[model samples]
Target: MAERHLEIEQKYDAAADFVLPELDGLPGVASAGEPEVHELHASYFDTADLRLAAHGITLRRRRGGTDAGWHLKMPAGTDSKQEMRAPLGRPLVVPARLAGLVAAYTRGAELRPVATLETRRTVVRLLAADGAELAEVADDLVTGCGPDAEPERWREIEVELKGGTPELLKAAGKRLRKVGAKKGKSSSKLGRLLGEAVVPAQAAAARAAARSRIAAATSNGKGPGITTGEVVLAYLAEQVEAIATYDPKARLEEEDAVHKMRVAVRRTRSALRSYRPVLDAERTVPLGPELRWLAAVLGEVRDLEVLRMRFAEAPAFVVEDLEKREKAAYRRMNASLREPRYFKLLDELDRLILDPPLAGAADRKARKELPLLVTRAWDRMAKDYASIKSADDPDVARHETRKAAKRARYAAELAVPVLGVAAKRVVKDAKRIQEVLGGYQDGVIAMEHLGTAAKRTKVPAEAFALGVLYGKEQCEALAARDHLSTTWSQTLGPSF
Candidate 1:
């Protein structure tokens, strides 16, 4: 079982011609790269209806590659893929547990074979000035066979970024171009697999960037309305990555993994409800029920974990303390929350994963519809910013700012692999706003907890302590809200 995918990198420029089909020796070369070849075969699984498309993922079982096994590929940012693999499957479909892990995206969609591919790989490595392997350039002669599409043959050279920058691709490119080893016209294997289905979100964004933001943010621009496509795609991509990144963590039962994964699930749902128009509701409307189930299950585990942690942070064995009694009740309730009820949850995830209830509608590729979607989402964000600008109440202003942050995050996440540094910078700034508001929300929750503790306590000191906590949070929230004026100004502009 080999966990494998071809990595294709295109270098921008180099000192000299680093073309392919190199002869034994070259002049003025300090060192050369070695290449090894491998035989690769992979069978990809997806619903005939394209259940995985909405989530931007593809699953497969592969053999003969360097790393082989059951592979789940979720979109990473713009152009990259986050490929997660498990050991050789005892049987196909997807292991119940493995499938359940991605239930948020798969929902009721079915999982079936969409395509199978076999490739004879020839490798050539590119090294640095130090003679270390800088990048892997593999030439793949491939055959793709599938149900919905035709069988095809293709030859491609891939330069995967293993331990180097995109800059390395440029450096290596100088030499490759001389021998006719030009950057392959396609972006990814899956992109080629889908053929005309591939959406050029980054390429679209490039064009959008050329236009004025104000023009795009308004309907006068050519894109979709705000909160429509951009937010949906962003949310879609984020959930897919969340599923892949947390897969290993969930299996390992790492602290807070369940909680973080659940948030990702919730975010996906939020995006769906938030931007219902731009997407084909026929496929997404049915998704809500399944998404709810996943969020509920994971949240239960997270809630219990949070309560357990709070209990540990409670004070000494003083019976007179009301806070102590609240802590005890919390522990007692949490103990009951972790029964067989949760044991079965992991299995539900499995059923959803291995046997999705996908309608054929989900399989349609929405790539051609990207710019309009992005523009729509940006419009909502811009409007929200305008609302904040006119807002007189600080609290109202802050809340509106939070909504804008979400829109920005949604856009950036969709373009992550595409927008590169610019998207990252936008997301980082918007996240700062989320953090400020999030802390204020935490204060509100903390105050409620303290009040509950106080009501259960007989001792005045216990009540006093609870009051102290409430007051502290209230003050914190106010200060944070006040600071937001300046923060929002910096982020959105002085008008905001």
Candidate 2:
């Protein structure tokens, strides 16, 4: 089984001759345990070009100490990381389970052994008043070797909290600083071994361009001026980062992971479509289908998740059947994650961001064109809402209107930084319309699920319960329809 936990720790540079400092006086640390020495060896893996390192992700296999395994570490915060561990295999290769999680970062790139660190670790546990261990501090003599570089040696101290607060770390650092310890030059052994050479060319170019733009903006006495390409790319980058951020949550089956992931896909597709004038259609238009494909697969499970929650009060048998369907849907969703097609889509997304196909329109300042784009989205949604006649069944029309509202909402969101309050107000109102239409569409979907369940069940009580659930869904749908016109008007009452 795979296990996960957060690795919260601090590191300080240590001279080769530096001696251990007293830990008993540190805040919350009552005493220190006898130091135990162990020899540890870790091999870091990344793309030949170091893609994972560039993104601040580390994958390694270690054989030493009590926690030996294949470890995947992702950045969590300033001084913490989330680590996923799998047991080491006999032959020593990256575990498939862990590899799947980094597919977004690696983009299925070939992960080869990049560097190896061998450490002689002296571990001292800091104890609390009641004799509970609060933290472990490791003083290490390290040797690092890579395929191309000669072996290098260094010394460092790592203060890792077991159950201690950050205050304890701060206190410990003060003691270390008194004895000539400084903050570590790099976050990890691998980082120091690779140095600054691991940065990808595209990443370097982006940073340089951003610096130049900021300098120019500073001289003009205004904040950085964003171009059409920058605005769309910023939105696109956000969604891309959202996908990366949510990957672990989705893999761990956290609440709303599937929904949030689907929304990222939808938002990216929406940005690509709405900003076609700025981005090259020939390059981005084809990605729409791939995004929809992913969202649809995810929806199979996400939709079932909502239905199960909505019908929680239904008969036990109906709820049991919903559970069965949800389990099956989730199985399919998990299986889809392992497919080559999904990883290919990730690779495509990476390529899109690294080298976007921008047109001449993308060069225009965002202030000149962003408002026009947002207004277009708002007007399109209004038109869609107006086409829904009162006498019509409205299911199809409501779904279409929801789609428009979603695009308008995301478009307005993209405009907020440049357009300010006017954009924010539109986003607020667009969200309400979207929610109303979403409820209507969900009700329609729930009623269909009830129909299907009724046909499948052999028991009379279950069928009757399904009937009652169907009626409730219909009533909810009617209510949503009743409020649609008023909500739509309210959403459009203000100008963009």
User: Best candidate per TM-score, number?
Assistant: 2
lDDT score, candidate 2, position 70 = 90
Worst 10 residues of 2 by lDDT: 203-212
Whole-model lDDT for model 2 versus the true structure? 0.83
Q: What's the number of clashes in each of the models?
A: 41, 0
Q: What alpha-carbon RMSD in Å does predicted model 2 have with respect to the real structure?
A: 2.9
lDDT of 1 by residue, 230-256 (tens): 434433544644654574455435577
Give the Cα lDDT of each candidate: 0.56, 0.83
Error of 1 at 158 (Å): 0.7
Judged by lDDT against the true structure, how good is candidate 1? 0.56
